[model samples]
Target: MAFHCYLWHGDTATAQGPKRDTLCGDLSMATPPVLTRDWLRKPQSMLRRKASTPEEAVNWLGEVFDQHAEKMTHSQVTGIRRQDRFGSALTDLQAGNDLSWGFPLVGSKYLALAVIVVR
Candidate 1:
């Protein structure tokens, strides 16, 4: 499927596959070549927290994710999917916000996430 570039209204999907029957895939690129979190960080898994203000949950979350992503899943596909975005469904999972990726099928063990962003 061709990569569709839309404004970051915070309501677009990072990936949209072809018909259910469609196969082989390649996502067109965006500038700055989306970097993995590991690549984004240097010399360490965690970047020093600029601030740990508990009152600003967003701050703590940003730091936690920045560090965790630096250590875990960092695929370009995943990174680019998140590059222009701030948080991941993964974050919610860690924060006890929402842990379900969703069911692949009704009540299926697998979960799904819908992220919308662009850069």
Candidate 2:
């Protein structure tokens, strides 16, 4: 099984993109990158991670950050009380709200690959 994530962009009500101010105001913003043929070239890489829950997704992201973005500060890396960046994202997701417009992880690369695995 593959991890399934839905990225919300534009407007669900009017079918338009989010307001510029709304996008610019939010701190933890994340938009799924456009799926490209180059990413598809290594099909197995996507399958390597198949998160079955929000917690699993957060764990996967944390592991990725630890491995790739070690230079980040302690606050950006810790998962204390589930109130960290990833934790906030999880809260938003659970409330049926789309993850706002920022990278939930520590690296710029993750912002481009913001896959939201929900089950």
Best lDDT among the predictions, by candidate number: 2
TM-score to true structure, per model = 0.23, 0.41
Per-residue lDDT of candidate 1, residues 1-117 (tens digit): 111111111111222223211211212222111222211122221222332222233344444445434334346226455534445543533343311111122121211221111
Q: Candidate 1: which stretches are off by over 4 Å?
A: 1-55, 76-84, 87-119
What is the TM-score of candidate 2? Answer: 0.41
Weakest 10 consecutive residues of candidate 1 by summed lDDT = 1-10
Task: Please provide, for model 2 over 1-119, each residue's C-alpha lDDT reduced to its tens digit, 9 standing for 90 to 100.
Answer: 23433323232221223453454233334322333222222234343355666666556655654564464456645535434667786665555443323233333233333434333
Q: Spell out the clash pairs found in candidate 2.
A: 5-116, 10-17, 11-16, 28-102, 29-100, 29-101, 29-102, 30-101, 30-102
Scored against the true structure, residue 52 in model 2 reaches a CA lDDT of 65
How many Å off is the CA of 23 in candidate 2?
Answer: 23
